[model samples]
Target: MSLASQRAGLSRLPLRAAAFVVLTCVAILGVSGWREWAARDAVLKGAETEMANVARSLTQHAEDSLDLLDSGVVGVVSRLEMDGTGPSTIAKLGKVLEARKTAVARIHSLAIIDDQGNWLTSPGTIASTLSDDTFFRHHQLSPKRDAYVGHPVKSVLDGQSVVTLSRRFNKPDGSFGGVVLATISAGYLSHFYEQFEIGRNSSVALVHGDGLIIARNPNNERFVGRSVADAPLFRDPSLQRPSGAYRFKSPLDGAQRVSFFKRSGRYPLLVLATVDQDELLAPWRAAAISRMLYVVALVMLIAIIGAVLVRQLQRGQRMAAALVEKEAHFRLLAEGSSDMVTRIGLDERLRYVSPSSNRVVGWRPNQLIGTDALAGIHPEDRPHVQAIVDAMKRGDMDEARLTYRNVHRQKSEVWLESTMRVTRKDNGTVDGVVAISRDITEQKNLETRLETLAIEDSLTGLANRRRFDERLKEEWARAYRDRSSLGLLMIDVDHFKSYNDEYGHPAGDACLRVVAKVIAAEVQRTGDLAARYGGEEFAMLLPNTDAAGCARVGERIRSAVHDAGLVHASNPAACVTLSVGGAACRPAFERTAGTDSLVEAADQALYAAKDGGRDRLMMSGEVTTLLPKASGQ
Candidate 1:
């Protein structure tokens, strides 16, 4: 009986050994294949990151160049605004333009065009009309006065290609006056693109949001100014985002590329940087092939020692059981934990969702698994969230924290602040991401409400001092840039202390509210600001307004208060009256002083008004003008 059983077992030994060898070889191939796949993924992600950084660098450089051109153009525009485009001014402007163009190395030419697009002056030898140019047509048709960056075109004066950054100037009556054009040579930008060290078939370019290739590296003139409007990247809704990256076949050359693009927040400019996928993965492919060959050799060696792996087979089963138990423990903790935990793949699909998702975002675990992680994200916030995820996937960061809005299953928008960690494979390459998000809607709302109250005056419903100071600083910078005037008016309730003592505090507050209302109503311009500076005193900020305009507004306020007819028996006028003072100054680019000087001068004028009489408006000596005394005075 024993001889038969032993013979049967001995016969099955070779078959069992053969099966072990085959299974071991298959396992080695599978693991090696997965590692090679991860290596390729790493290569692609690294290439994308490199492209993104290059795109960002190019974008910043472009913005700096455009900004330099803008400053030069703004000065010329201001001159044309202050002084008409008469022959004398044009002759002087031509010389000024030549000097400026020489001083600014980036500018190829500077010219002033008439309202009809007649070139009034050109730094080039030949003056030419730009009546049919895109820039001229844009300024003529659109009332917007912001700087416009036009497509590449051959300059009529020099017969060379150039990109024009133009601005529209206005007449004294705010009518369309003309355009100030600053030209940047295309050749110079091409030279600037030469510094990048991208490999073969790679490109760096400046693209317009409308899909015009404004400029490109590798010195491809044929690609410049070409329309790529129908390209996948341009057609995608992501074009509206400030910055993003995409991988697609080039519509121009049909080359596959992992193109990274960054869009300018201020201009219609796009900086594109790309790397040829095949070239970028060349090294990875070589290494992967060699590693697979090694795996094949190791499989043959394992086949000879198949019997020796019996003990390892038993150990592997034990380890697998332990891992299964550990995974179950993790699930238990995830389900019981208060915070919602999720694992998201690079495709933005949820790999794992915890039970707490129901309590967190009003979705069950089953409802979220295998669904797009971004489906619940707010439309406006998805771009930023996607960028953060991309950065982690690209190995730029190991952990990230962000706050975003999520649409709850109940149809409510809830703010969620999440802390995310990049999950990695054993090869140290990225796997996906693990994120823990908690509801922050309540905290965010409270913070927003508190911020609003911080800058508002509760008593008079006007801007408080903090807000006034902040706005004045910004307006001062704007006025300094445009070389325009900034006016400030200080108003004080005449005999306010006496009125408060006689009529009680409540009545005094009511009077202040009424005064604030009058000040706000009188200063109604888009750039105007009326603030309750402090108790019983208010301030009005008028940008782009001259001294006479400020005095007129001050007079209106005083006369309106006098007409209000609020009784004040303790005062000499027997009614509430305002002592108003106004001062204006054309902000100078050469000045180093801040807006504090303007406020101090206006305050001095208000004291003068109060000293002369209780209810009168006084103008500072910046301009020789003063309104007639108010009726109460």
Candidate 2:
């Protein structure tokens, strides 16, 4: 051999020794990595399954608490409204809230709060210490539902985290009254997570859809309420695995660890199981060193045989490298497409996120990779979106198109039209959903504007006759159902034919506009609509407003029209006055009343107003005594 060959020969002994050591280390690393991956995956799956069971168990336990609360408040409100009394109401509310304290320990107290924000009762020493609470402020304004569950908050009663469920009571007229508020404990949630059997360095966190950390186990002093929204696993663009191992510096311990993550329902929750990387590979590392020493001793006895064997292995490695390159190239193309692609699980979490997310949602690819995709939807659209998702999960609907408003980055709202279809695997299992959302706010707004223009009157800004009649029909049905009162006012400009005879039609038009404005201003209440019935006659439809309220509005309109300073000399009626006649009668929905009869009732009242000295109001019930005008006059 040449001198270089001789040097290579001398180095061959050490090189063989070193090659055995390196190969042994690589094999050990591969085996240890595989085992660590499996162990971490198992730990996450077990913990997540356990936590899900805990959530179910706690839901059952809390069910009775919620139902009891619903029953108690319903009874209390019913009695209060029926009796029209407030004396024993507060005491009854306090008793019910105190009674449930054993089941829900976090409730400081229970009380009734009116719409004006005055608490009727309080629990324990809190009543003596503080006089007012915002809990009732929010509850009174809320719609009357079974119960209003407040977001989790620190209790004023006990200084512990809890949620309050308030039930609203309505007045006899269907107006909202005060609310009965009951606070519920958060202890059940903590108890639920405790059963998960988290390892020494393992943790489970519940994050809100907005990334607010709701709760966690092995509670870190700093990470409990903080948003891990900026973490690389949450913000990076390359993460697309459903349940995979990844290395990241732990926010709590500040040590590099391998974590396996599984996301919960599109509710902004993530379950992570982590272990220190060095600790996981410790056993395999030791085994690898031991194997390298044994291989070095064997290689010394057969150097020439090892050289041929290494050359064949190198050729095989080159072939494997070429295949890996092709696979990677295709994966990049699939992930980087323009379509808004996602893989959703049966549980409604995102299993995969494509690079298209950056353009579609203003989020980097990894920002929502393992996040609950449902949480990204607008609150108003959640039910519909979840329904479709659930249907697909149950194999009901295959494709669906839904449009809903989504909040953009700068707090502006944008409407998106999402087209979603089911994705299935070759083995006939659902992989997830692939959806494309295109901005459609402009289109929806245009459609809405066109619909509004069709329904609304252009000049007077009141509902047209069509809309008014539709509303009257709706009110008629409601009044019939509740056995409540309904009133209609037919306002006719006094001697409009004579006024148009004297002044030009344009002046008559101006007078009509002014009268419409006055009539509209007088009858401004919920369920009250003023619309041009036809010609100069404007009709006001009032539901739930009794005869007294209608009379008050009628007098106000009479005064407002006279104040407008328009002149009408016909029949010596007051200057520019409207002779308004109201028919106050509860409409029957099922048993029909003739339209002519209803108009006749109002028309009779108008004649009564005209005879009772114009610029006056007349009701259907009092028309006979109010006016006895001769038909010819």
Clashes of each: 0, 0
lDDT leader: 1
Question: Candidate 2's residue-wise lDDT over 1-633, tens digit each?
Answer: 233234334446545665875566566656756765676566555544554554444334345555666666677677767865366766765666567655555444455666665656653523432333544656556664556654455545555555456677777887777776665445544555566553455555544333445455656323444666777767766644444455688776686666565554322344555555556556656865676566555644455565666666656555544544433554476476775666676667776667766666767767887778887678988898888888887778789998887766554677778788897755666657777777677798899998888777877777888888788878877887897777778888888888888887888888889998988887667889988877788888888866787777787888899888787766465478888888765555324453344456777887899888778898786322223231111
How much lDDT does each candidate structure score?
0.84, 0.65
Worst 10 residues of 1 by lDDT: 624-633
User: Where in model 2 is the C-alpha error above 4 Å?
Assistant: 1-341, 345-347, 351-366, 394-397, 497-508, 567-575, 588-596, 611-613, 622-633
Task: Write model 1 residue lDDT over 169-205, tens digit each, in one string.
Answer: 9989998999998877776777788888887889888
Question: Candidate 2: lDDT of 337?
Answer: 74
